[model samples]
Target: MDNLPISSKYRSRPLEPLGDAEREQLAERLNDEFARGGIDTDAYRAMLDQVFAANTLGEVASVVASLPAKDTFAVPVVIETGTAAPGELLPARTTGLRAPLLLVAGLGTGIAVAILLVVLIIL
Candidate 1:
């Protein structure tokens, strides 16, 4: 039986080895789950071991599969002081233009004439 080749089902490598970047990301995900108490110390250590030994992204994904997904977006809450903390993401600003534009358009010709009169009076 020594002459028999190893069975393919148990013998060869099927997945690429995990890289540093992927390892770091998996560690961070594991930390997030641990911090959230989703996994206890023993489980965290076990999963972390899996992450370090992981051969592929699929393996890393399986390691985190039992934990709740981490929230990707963080909304920064600001106080009335209006100063944002360091590293906080600022909310977007938009001009309040659309409502006034639609109102002016709907008022029709009489408002247009009145606006023209105001400009003429100013001139």
Candidate 2:
């Protein structure tokens, strides 16, 4: 086999300083990755602190590069139509309608209790 010639030697350059917006964007990306379980809590916290402290874009990039690549998980899409038979039962929607109502009711009760307590304290 013939020996192949090396193309070009890589040259290292000084890292450019990161702007405020660029730093924020990188932080968001890292947070998203962490939310996806790409990195553990410890690693995420360390990396986040480093990202905030990083002055150069290269430093942030290095932290990002250390994390694993995002997985290509496919999300299933569901399409519902109101054409079901009258006698058929349908699955409950994931959206918690009752939960919000209950939450509001609980908050209202809590405020009323707090007001009553304050009135009793004053008297």
TM-score of each candidate structure, all chains considered together? 0.42, 0.43
Highest lDDT: give the candidate number. 1
Q: Rate the local accuracy (lDDT) of all candidates.
A: 0.70, 0.70
lDDT of 1 by residue, 73-99 (tens): 777786556688987888888758988
Q: lDDT tens string, model 2, 1-123?
A: 012113211112216776798678667888888898888999888988988997775566557566554444776687566978977998887766988999999999999999999999999
Residue ranges of candidate 2 with Cα displaced over 4 Å: 1-14, 67-123
Q: Write down the worst ten-residue block by lDDT for model 2.
A: 1-10
Residue 62 in candidate 1, Cα distance off native in Å: 1.9
Model 1 scores a C-alpha lDDT of 0.70
